[model samples]
Target: MPFKINTNLSALDAYNALARVNAQTNKAQLRLASQLRINSVADDTSGYRVGKELEGKVTLMKAAQGNIGAAKNTLSTAESALTNINDLLIQIKGKIAEANDPTKNLTALANDINALGDEISAIFTNTKFNDTALLSGSALPSSSNFVFQTGETEKTTINFGTMNTLDLASISSSGATSSNITSLSVSTLETAVQDSLGKIGNYVQRLDVKDDYLTSAITNATASVSRLFDADMAIEQLKATKGQIGQQVSTTMLAQLNFQPRSLLTLFQ
Candidate 1:
């Protein structure tokens, strides 16, 4: 290369190289400071897009988990109400059996049996959670199934079936007389309580399984999001150190190259 007084090509080349090194150093430092591999879309376009999609999915999944929790709570509240209703039915059955005995006073037995029936009706009407009725006839849905969202996908749902009215009127308890009580089918009331309890038990078990599954899924999704977005601190620090060294070396070379043209001028002196 020919040496020129007006322009030093070697110094220009060294300065450009130093600028590139400085830019790289700044990028590495930014990664270390932010603790994210993809701070901007320009850093890694495809990775950034994919990471954003994954982040959205994670957010939706978290919201779905909250929905699942609410569904579980609703089921639990219903289950507790049904359990109380079941106990009330058992007491009603005992009262009916006592009224069946010939030795008991008919009027006193009728009063006791009617009192127990009133309590059962009261429970059926009063059983509520979050101000929403759970056991009353008014609370029964037209469709048996209650769907709960369990995942990010629109199709992912947990369908709960078998919700039914637990009204005291469902059971034949108007027969307060001993002769009438002897004819009443206590077995029918027993069967209704047992069936409702069984359905509630099954629903609670399924909800528990779904809750565990969501917990695991959230953990895995969080890990995936982290892998896409989070920077490895150790690797970033090492890269920053290497870039810093390269910048120092390039700056020194640029300074040396600037002095080379002056040395050529000393030849004339």
Candidate 2:
């Protein structure tokens, strides 16, 4: 018999099998932890790119939604104040009618009417949301910038329209010889009130349009986010199955390699 050293092919086969099994195990774990088919850039670079884009849009949409909420509240306050002004104007009209009568005195009524005008003026000046008055004498900007995760504006045009300017000073202050009150025509007061009411209606309509836009933006953002990051359970199940099969096949191949080393036993026979 020839003197020879035998190599442990079984050990080499076992090592190879174990290495493959370890690799498959690691891949399965990564998929589970990340809950994504394309966890790394190597997996799907395009998916990562588009996923980040959608994520940015979602962030912008959230900020826009918050702005809409603030706009709604401010507009509501404007609407409420306008209603109070309407009531005040009606009261002033009644006072003027009483003053016109021969039985009533004008001096006391003039003071009361002046006070009502002052109160309306104050409401216009002082009414504020976060200390930014919507109906001030000067038109203040009710503007905000929505910053996205990508540090850019996804859609820049966010206008809540302008606030109504119902100038209280324009109303007549004279008691006995006023153009609006002394020459009292329901048509004139009605026209003024109707104009204010029309402005209020217009603002309310604008508010509704903004609200609807925000709602739609949020919906679309949510859908985009889901598409970008949500996992596909069906695809993951298939991958897991394939990983198990690969592990099994490698183990079988390793066993066959081990059998090759056992051929040395035939020499002894």
Candidate 3:
């Protein structure tokens, strides 16, 4: 090799190697400090995109879980009201049966029945969830469908049909007589209460299942995001150590190569 004082090719190569090592060391240090493998889109383009997608899905699932909880609470409130209504109907049925007896005061029994009916109507007016009437035959929010986002691209919904309202006061017993009590269709009211209870029970079960699914989906999605974005501290520490050693050695080698051109002065001596 011809010795050149003006330009040392060996020194230039060492400098380039040192720069590469320093860049690698900085990258490893950044990864360690941030605790993330892909801090930016430039770190891992495909991984970053996929991880962000998974993160979005996790966020959506968490929100859906909250919606499911609110829906469950709404259904629970409605169920409680329906249960009370059912109990009142049962009491009215008993009162009607008592009115069928000749010895019982028909006026008092009629008053009791009317009072129970009024209470049932009050329940319809008072039963609400989050200031929205749940059992008043009103159209439910979200277009009669209680829609909840269960996934990034999917949704679950419950339709509280218009058959929810019950006007028990309209079933009158104005004639205070055994014949009137027997003619009253209390069985129809019982059936309506049972049907409403069944619907609410079914909806509650569905919401519970959806809530469980969303919770599991969020867990899995979070894990997926972690795998794509989170850094392995052990691996990064090792890589950083190697990069530091490489940088130190390359810098030392560059210094030595720089002195090689100075050794050409010895030839002139």
Candidate 4:
């Protein structure tokens, strides 16, 4: 090869190699310090976009999760109220049956039936959750988004018309006579209780599924973001070490090459 002092190609090559090594070393160290794979949009544009989109979904899913929880609480409240009312109805029916014994006091039995009916009326008036009447046949909420889900809110209508049988006060008003004892029936109230309980159960089951699904989705989504944005500590440490060695070697080589043209003076000597 012909030696040229004016243009040291070998030195230029060595300098370029050093620059590459320096760039690699800086990148590795930055990744290690930040613990992130994508430091900027330019690092991984597509991954950045997709990860950001998933973050938004995760936020929305969390909100939906809270909504579902509130909905379940509401249903639970209504269910508890109905259960209490059902027990009271059972007591009223028992009192009516005992009225036929002729051994029990008819006036006392009538008072007991009237008291139970008053309790049932109170339950109908006071069965509420968060100040919203649940069993009064009023719509739970005007807004459809009250309990937001993935695409929309889950809407359910529970009818409480059978609650009408809760009143045994009229027949047993004057006395627990034979006519009154025979006419009073709590079967309708029992059926209504079963129906409302079943409806609440169905709503709870659906909410449980959604709750489980959201939990899984959040975990999976967070993992996806980690995969795209989190740095691999072991790999980054290796890269940083390798790049550090390359940087030292390339810098030394560049210095040697830059001074190598001085050897050409020996030819003149």
Candidate 5:
């Protein structure tokens, strides 16, 4: 009620209301433009912190998904190489069985068998991708196995596990006289062939397990990324409605402020 030259009380009250409304309008404008309630750290510090943690989880999960991809490729290569080896064993077994019969030419059978051994060796030597041979013996001075490490926490190794390097060597005519081959009957050759198939089957099983693990990781990562960055349409829609009302209120408050300073005009009338 005090008459002051510089500050009219009614004008000051109107202006205070207008300023509050303006602040709300600005907030609404930002939310509408960004389509998000939490655009800046100032809007919601706790939300920003939680979002950062979720973002980190998304990054790690994505990397794990990639690790699974590389692992699958490696296992696939191994499976393919073993398949070739199995096929070779089958051919060798059939030839050896025919050679064992008196009706077949023993000398020609020996040549064919020797040729097969050489072919299997060739398969082993040639089975490589990205400069890494899957079938070849590891030349690591300390061991016959090779460990594939993706990171400090994850690793998968190929042990050539008990591949018959000896049986492979025996496919030659020079090694034909060995008891293992000379004594090999139709049943024995069949058993050897089956054993080769078994090794490949075992490797494939392990790959299946690895594949499953990676598939799960990819799914989880995909979900986490969605949670961290995706918007909620329902929540945003409600906010947009509220923002519209706030802007209107701000404009009305500004009009009221202008009129309050003009109250002196009523005295002149």
Candidate 6:
């Protein structure tokens, strides 16, 4: 190396090396402070984009899980109401059969039937979850009538059957007249309730499977995002320590090189 007084070339080179060590040290420290590998898109452009997309999917799947829970709750409410109605129908049928006996009080049995019918009507009208009616006489029964968004890119529809117009509360006509059992058709009403129960059971099974899948998908997606964005503490700490050591060594070398030019003045002394 040629000695020069105008410019200390050796010092300049050392200074540049020091600057590089300082930059590397700062990058490691930043990662340590933030606890993230990719703090900005500049860190890893492709990783950042893909990680954000995965995070968005996780959000949507979480919402879909919530929807599945709500759908199950609604079905549960409907099932409860229908089960109670089925029980009442059973009681009414028994009362009608007893009315045929010679010893049974026909008028009293008819009153019992009316009271049971009223209870069933009350259940149908009052059944609800979150203020949305599950079973009411006015709902009108149909197949796959109610819709619920149960998953990402998926939907589930349920039946909300109504028994309001069945006239269960007034099965026995004119207070003293025969029940006119054929006109009321308690058996048919019971069958409809049973069918709703079966459908609800099936729907719940499907929901359970779907919920399990969402739970797993969410877990895996979150892990993937973490791998893309989260910092490794051990690796970052090692790098920071190495950079700090390099910075110290480079600074010492720069100071020595900067002092070398001053030796040239000794000739004048």
| TM-score of each predicted structure versus truth | 0.86, 0.70, 0.91, 0.79, 0.73, 0.89
Off by over 4 Å in 6: 137-144, 161-184, 266-269
CA lDDT of each prediction against the hidden true structure: 0.70, 0.61, 0.79, 0.77, 0.60, 0.81
Off by over 4 Å in 5: 3-5, 9-13, 137-154, 164-167, 177-181, 184-229, 265-269
Task: Show how many residue pairs clash in every candidate, following the order shown.
Answer: 0, 0, 0, 0, 0, 1
Best by lDDT: 6
- For candidate 3, the 10 contiguous residues with the lowest summed lDDT are 169-178
1 or 6, greater by TM-score: 6
Higher-TM-score candidate among 3 and 4? 3
lDDT of 4 by residue, 1-269 (tens): 99999999999999888888888889899999999999999999999999999888888778878878888887788789889988997898898888878788876777778777777767777877778777653644542123345322444343434443344445334534445764677787778887878877887898888889889988899999899999999999999999999988998888889999999999999
Model 4, CA-based lDDT: 0.77
Alpha-carbon shift of residue 73 in model 6 (angstroms): 1.1
Badly placed stretches (over 4 Å) of model 2 are 1-25, 137-139, 142-197, 264-269
Report the candidate with higher TM-score, 2 versus 3.
3
- Sort order, lDDT high to low: 6, 3, 4, 1, 2, 5
Model 4: how far residue 14 lies from native, Å: 2.5
True-vs-predicted CA distance for residue 180, candidate 1, Å: 2.5
Residue-level lDDT of model 6, residues 1-269, one tens digit each, is 67689999999999999999998889899999999999899999999999999999899889989999999988888888898888888888888778777788776876777777767767877887777667664443453266777777788887754444445545533432344532344777887788779888999999999999999999999999999999999999999999999999999999999999888888889
Rank the candidate models, highest TM-score first: 3, 6, 1, 4, 5, 2
Candidate 4 weakest lDDT stretch, 10 residues: 143-152
Higher-lDDT candidate of 1 and 4: 4
- TM-score of predicted model 6? 0.89
- Candidate 3 — number of clashing residue pairs? 0
